[model samples]
Target: MILIRGKWRTASVGFLCTLLLLVFLATPVWSLVSRSGDQIIIGANEVIADDLYVAGRTITINGTVNGDLVAVGRLITINGTVQGDLLAAAQAVVVNGTINDDLRVVSQVTQLGSNARVGDDAVAAGMSFESLAESTVAGDLAFTGWQALLAGNVGRNVTGSMAALELRSNVGGNVNVITGAEGDAPEAYPPFFPQPPVPIPQLRAGLTVADSVQISGNLTYRSPGVATISQQAQIAGGVLREELPEDETAAPAPVTTIAQQLQYFIALVLVGWLLFKFVPNWIQSLAAIASSKPLPSLGWGIVTFLAVGIIAIAIAFVTFVLTALSAITLPVLIFPVLGLGTLANLTLIFGFLLFVMFVPQIVVSLLGGRWLIHKLQPSTSSNRFVSLAIGLLIFVLLTAIPVLGGLLHLITIFLGLGALWIWIRNNRDRAPTEPQLAAV
Candidate 1:
């Protein structure tokens, strides 16, 4: 029993440690640092020399970051400087300081304050993007969202796809926009008609160029109606309009056929056979642990499953950051990045297939088979092969039953996974120092 417990603990610990090691190895810990919390603030006097990664509910960067800054939060405000590129995602983003490189942001509302400056391109995607007067983007400005109010200056082009674009700015190069067409105005209700308590602001679609705007190059736009260009606005090149394409309809989800089910069943059977043939003892031990303490097993399984998902996400996010770094700085790092990504992907896929898709079902079926066999034929109850077969057959059949099957399958997976997790945790440190001299 001690030996069995030790093996279970070893297995769980080994699997978790392997995933942690992979993540630790993949990250560029020497060059980057990270922080997360409910509210994160980088004080004005503080400075981070390495690339910074941060996530929180509210994030404020008043200090200087000598390297790239990547942030995600509910409200993000950068009041100091970023010596390198700035990549941010939040509900609202306000940049009032300087970014020596590109600024990439995704948010509900993105604002470049009057003192804001970007040494390179400024790319933003959100519901509304506003570049206040006096702010400047040294390179091109790109935006994709519902409304864009450009009152600042652009060193190069201004390109965007939006519902409403109001430009009261200066562009050194071309201005290209894809904006919405004018929709029918709301019908006027009778004077005595009751109106809604709160008034909803409506957006007037299409581009609106103010008299103060200046474009050194051509103006190209795609919209159903002509753009509103002020006569006082300066444009060195001619204006061109392109036709807008119609929206594509989404396709319906594909239904799983009977053949797919048969194939899946066969695959599970083969996998079970392999496990039964090589790790029969391990299987029986896990079943025993699960049967003895069902609740604990279920709880552990839920935690493990969630942990695995979080690990996979972390791996993917790290891969993306590494790929970006390789592209920006060290091109040679691409080889290692690719290899790491591939390995991580394979590991995650295998883990999902084994733990989520197969292990739970197998464990539950085995337990069920043992229980049913003991009740029906006590003499043959110890026959592992016969027990597994009976359990798996019944499990598969019940899991094939329409609505109830899905719920039952889900419950079985949770229970099985929990049992495995419990066994590992309970026995990992209980391994015997030497071979047993006698059997129980």
Candidate 2:
């Protein structure tokens, strides 16, 4: 029983490694993920046998992906066929290919070329979504964006929440829209028949259906303003519009202001005080190591940053592929796998955020505190608040600077991270070695 317990414990430790890899591959790869001029391109004649996952500044796929294609970059263009799902996030997404399955995208601008065909649902959110007249979607078109211009044929429903909509298409199913508040009422023109145009209120969001539109199913919409439908617009099932209440619809929050900065200062001071009270020694040690080995610390910081990122990508690729396989061959194990995958994703997100937000601040402040104490050569009777306050103030000021302040912020991050990494590594090396067993 004792031997069996030991084996199980060892297995658990091994399982933890898998979790780390999965976490690494998760979303936090955004840090050190993309590099300018490092574009990944699939040539026009090439073909990929398996799944392709890529991250860079610009990515273009002109060949064929036999499996799913997942990409994150500044510019993404797919001009070939993806035999499986297409998942992409970028500044610009242009699809001129055929997607055998679902097409999902998040970007500043998304364009589905006239020749593009999506076998399944086409989901996208961006500043603008344009489906040209020649495009054909075999499934629903669901979108949330600033503007949606549809001139294509949708096999099923067309649904979107947008600021502006231009529909010149045929929908086989329902048409649902939530328009924004930036549309003007149609202008009055003198008609020879002598019927004056009635006055109407300005719409925050406007919906326009051209004469070319044909909806076989019910047309539903929720908007603060009314839609403008051309006389020739055909709707077999009629239209249903629910007016959105002013109170129920919320606007975006304002940008950061001085009040928010002051609040942040107060919160930082309180948090620093708590950290000081409980972990003074650890903080001091990190600062001391950082100050003494500045270059080494910075180097280690870069290394650690990259190592975590690479590990994460590997994990994500492995997890996705394995999950797909398990869903097919070992359905019974899917739940446990999904649970682990979720945990891995959370770990990556939280860990990245922790380092990005807290570690740098703590390390830099601690260094500033140490520097202040040394410069003043204060007596034993001196208050610790003076040093803490000075450190926090310096950091805050540096962060406030325009362009140069951004550089300082980055430096401070490296200094702190490098110092922490060095300290941890040294301590681990200094730990006592396990005792060797002697034969009985």
Candidate 3:
């Protein structure tokens, strides 16, 4: 009995120490360094285990990390393997390795290496993507650029918006491409889906590989412009081609979900980078402060996301209702007004979508900032970092309390929204208006 008791005591102590270490790491010190007043640099060679990152500088990963990577920085480059999701922001990003989960990166130029392998989706938001065919990603591939060269393997679909899009690899899913036409803009799609994104339009000059493509699933193209596919592609699924009367044969584009994820990440990076650009010193300070209250900030962030998501969904439902009214209730004689109302509802829905989409970016930036201040300033009432660490420990242990986790989860989203609200309100126009002169 004594022996068992001794073992239990030792284990508890060990666990406590480990917990302490994690909390310590949560600070701005050894783990992630970002401050509102100082510049920090993270040049990691590699990580042996799963990792989560949050920073405010040029974060360059040249080593292996076996965990999720979440970073907000001026620049981030991952030249190593990540066993989980790779989330980052910067002016440029180059990923060359194996990512077990999803890869969400936003930068001006995102390059995937030939040896890169992703278990799930690979989303990239960039102006240009040089995707090596040698890269093996066992999931979907998505992009939002007019310039993408796919020379790799995609397990799922491919979606993109580009001027010059190329594909030279095996894909496991369908492909959805939309871009400006090459010649007179590719042909328009026959009315099939709910509604087309745009009317027939011309390509502004770009190369595309829509021909000779093999798709395992159905293809969906939404472009008003021309896309000239390369002759070396083989689409397994029946090609659902789109064309305008005056356009050339449409070239294919990239996939979807993965690309959407990438866009999400890219937007994060851009918004963060933009913040830093306008206030480098302030950003550095924010990072420094943020580390002091990571748990609190993180908790809040969760709340904001939930709130926004719910609100957005509600807006979408309302829009859908209006659309239904216009489509069904409105008489054919009053089609124009119905159409007008539908458009208005859609516009409102879109605005809400944008709000939900960018909400995280705004919240995180402020969280990062506040955390930075807490760490650097350390409130007199308590060492914010220490208090935060204790609070986190309490929160974790309270899981046995029942319903705590659920409550915490809900509370987190609200906090996030609060921070985001602050961020947006802070950036509200203070500039001299030409004049609040004439109403349109």
Find the candidate with the highest lDDT and give its number: 1
For model 2, the superposed segments whose C-alpha errors exceed 4 Å read 1-37, 182-204, 247-440
Give the TM-scores of the predictions, in the order they appear.
0.49, 0.49, 0.47
Once superposed on the true structure, which residue ranges of model 1 sit more than 4 Å away at CA?
1-25, 183-203, 245-440
Task: Please report, as a residue range, the 10-residue window in candidate 3 with the lowest summed lDDT.
Answer: 431-440
- The TM-score between candidate 3 and the true structure equals 0.47
| lDDT of model 2 at position 308 | 72
* Overall local distance difference test of candidate 1: 0.69
- Residue-by-residue lDDT tens digits, candidate 2, 179-270: 65435431211123222121212222468889999999988877676788888999999988888765433222112333455676676677
Comparing 1 and 3 by TM-score, which wins? 1
lDDT of 1 by residue, 148-223 (tens): 8899999988876776778899999888777766443212212333332222233456778899999999988877
Error of 3 at 382 (Å): 16
Clashing pairs in 2: 24-312, 25-312, 180-204, 180-205, 181-204, 181-205, 182-204
- For each candidate, the alpha-carbon lDDT, in order, equals 0.69, 0.65, 0.51
Error of 1 at 125 (Å): 1.3
